[model samples]
Target: MIENPGILFSVLAFLCAIGPLVFIHEMGHYTAGRFFGIKADAFSIGFGREIAGWTDRLGTRWKIGWLPLGGYVKFAGDMNPAGVPDAAWLALPAAERERTFQAKPLWQRAIVVAAGPFVNLALAVLILAGFAYAYGVDRTPPVIDQVAAGTPAAAAGLAPGDRIVAIDGVAMATFSDLAKFALIRPGQAVAVTVQRDDRRQAMPLTIGTVRQRDRFGNEYRIGRLGIAGGKPVYAPVSLIEAPLAGVRATAEIVSGTVETLGQIISGRRSIDELGGPIRIAKVSGEQMSLGWPAFVWLLALLSINLGFINLLPVPLLDGGHLLFYAVEAVRRRPLEPQAQEWAFRGGLAAVLLLMLVVTFNDLGAVGVWQRLAGLIG
Candidate 1:
């Protein structure tokens, strides 16, 4: 029997973390649709059987479901949560079609579809900005204070007192910037520019890779540059500056995600590194145990990731809808309904495959496969 309080807490924390994010994402779609005079049939916080629900004056059924995995806003004419237009509704009289999502102008429909992911992105930015305003921004200079022997820094002939000014021609304004750039590019070669005394020189080196475990025993393989920087420094950010700081932080996260995905696509990184709901739940619980601050930070990070993922050009995702809209705009007509149906089917299969792969990776991460092997042996 599982008796660990921590395990239970992790499950609760996972719900606490994901539930609101999903609600907010669905709310974004709901609100945007309403703004354009489109009627929604349902605003559901999960899929499958309804746990509880009530109908609002607008006749929208607001409900919670047992699954708690994700949520969706079902527009008046949607055939399902994926928002495919119902052929029956499409054939309805023009007067009845006015309030349907399909009846909206192309631009309005695009906005409604795009709003969900953009709202997630905006939420992340706001949360980060709040943090910056409450605390401050890191202002540590990118000067190398020590270069560990036999490491990448040493191999590249980098020395103490050399200041990192750029990596691959991109400016590094702070030590944090340097770390962020290198962290996602494990074992990747890069050109590092540094200023030693009065002369600036560029050196080529491969970032070292290291396997490390977090406090909760979660393992990660990350880039390591075996160099130390000077003492930490932080500067207070004003309310006006906080938003900018948040934007910069969000941009960094986006770039890092893109870089990591690119590496994974190119087979430079192991597929095992990909994580799913299980990994997220584990991390969420760990972060919650740390403190509210840590948990909140994780929330913001995950929110940004949620937003970014929805923007990808995959069918059944917000991006996929946008892609169809883009094609519709260019073609001066919608694609054949048959083609769209097939595309959605393909997308659904791809999405399901991804979920399975990530879940398998998550199981491996939690030692489920190892335990099964031991039992079999």
Candidate 2:
């Protein structure tokens, strides 16, 4: 049994958030292909039966799909939506072949395939920049409001009304800078500099570590000084600075994701943090509840992830197509059709397997099995 309203909202929010992004991504390929004289057979935003459709003058069938999760643009000379070519495509009239995706020059094909991910990247950057420009960055000085008694802050003589000037010798531009600096170096001593009553003071403090777990069951230790944050003040940004700040923030997010993946690969981080469509829907709903800005932020982040993941050299993905093109370029001919077929099959299997694992992780995060076990117990 499922909760109607909750599940409905989650599904709806997930669709609303994902549908446009997927369409935009596919359009990147479609538009590029069209620009290079590569004809599109169909442009469908979703899978399965068409909800609504119209045939364009260009002989392309454009339609909405019943499923709102993802979409694709089937190109001329393509065997399938995944852009694999077939013998029939090569047997087409010479003039028609010129407009088919497979008949395009290697460089053109590369551009068309790469366009999807590149468009996603551009969308994220643009969204971030637009939001930052409209609502300048939230700035709050790292001022301690209340120092918890018996905590490391109190032990270090940190008092209320004191402002954190720096942590670990790094300038604390905002309270987040301090928290990030402390959290990453749990159980480590950090050099703290504070501004007290117009006087600057430097003190050494050992950060206390506290074990914390998220709803996903991933546990980690974070350094805590037990100081409550003060009120935030939004700093207005100049038109020129907003986009630049957005770029910086986007870069930081990409870098952080890379670092996290690296840690997980090295076994320094848990694979349990990996999530799939379920997790995404849950997060999307939660973010939607938080408000539009936050939801948009999630969209931007997801866009970045989509772009990044699609750029990976995995089969059945845009990155995989790029990889194939690279090899073809080097060899002055394409890979054997049988070899490409096997590669696609393997890639499809791998993608589905990965999705299954992430969905299981999502179920675990939701505590479905835990509840069943509790009932049995």
lDDT of 2 at 88: 78
| Steric clash count of candidate 2 | 0
Question: TM-score for each prediction?
Answer: 0.96, 0.79
- The TM-score obtained by model 2 is 0.79
Residue-wise C-alpha lDDT for candidate 2, range 271-325, written one tens digit per residue: 8878888888887777776678878999999999988889989989999999999
- Candidate 1 accuracy as lDDT: 0.89
Worst 10-residue lDDT window for candidate 1 reads 1-10
Q: Give the distance in Å from residue 286's predicted Cα in candidate 1 to where it truly belongs.
A: 0.4
